[model samples]
Target: MSGKAGTETMFRFTCPACEMSPIVDAVIRADMLANGCYLCGTQVSESAFREVCEE
Candidate 1:
């Protein structure tokens, strides 16, 4: 993917504390989402957000 198409590959990181999801400007690898929070210093992953969204 390139140009506009590459933009779609970007993912947003949501803060677990404030529930503020920010669209990260940089590209995030699939594995990186399994770690900790980049915003509110919480330990979270993509699955965590999915769980929150489900509730």
Candidate 2:
């Protein structure tokens, strides 16, 4: 994780709340730790979103 308070990377994944719909604006650490949804500002599932990152 970036040590700074306001640093992030853009992650695209499926929305877990909306029936796995593809989402294109999640933010995790550069190391793939869970952050928040850049679209809706929700930090729901970091690990699940991280799994889809390799795609």
Candidate 3:
């Protein structure tokens, strides 16, 4: 088995409008990714997502 089999990087997102806690396991794959926060219905920007520890 390969040693690097499970080294997927995750991202955390926080809603700017609601100031909610980091969003768990946020997967973003675009340079211009934009979405809405599920909890507070706020528009999420690319800058809001941050890199998290690899698992």
TM-score of each: 0.42, 0.31, 0.60
Q: Please give, for residues 2-55, the per-residue lDDT of candidate 2 as tens digits.
A: 466643444556555444445344333332235544445455565545433332
RMSD of 2: 8.7
Residue-wise lDDT of candidate 1 within 7-52, one digit each (tens)?
3444556666768775553334243355555555566666543222
lDDT of each: 0.50, 0.45, 0.62
Winner on TM-score (2 vs 3): 3
Candidate 2, TM-score vs. the true structure?
Answer: 0.31
Q: Which stretches of candidate 1 lie over 4 Å from their true place?
A: 1-8, 25-35, 48-55
Better candidate number, 1 or 2, judged by lDDT: 1
For model 3, residues 1-55, the per-residue Cα lDDT tens digits are 5677656667676667888755455344232144477666676677777878754
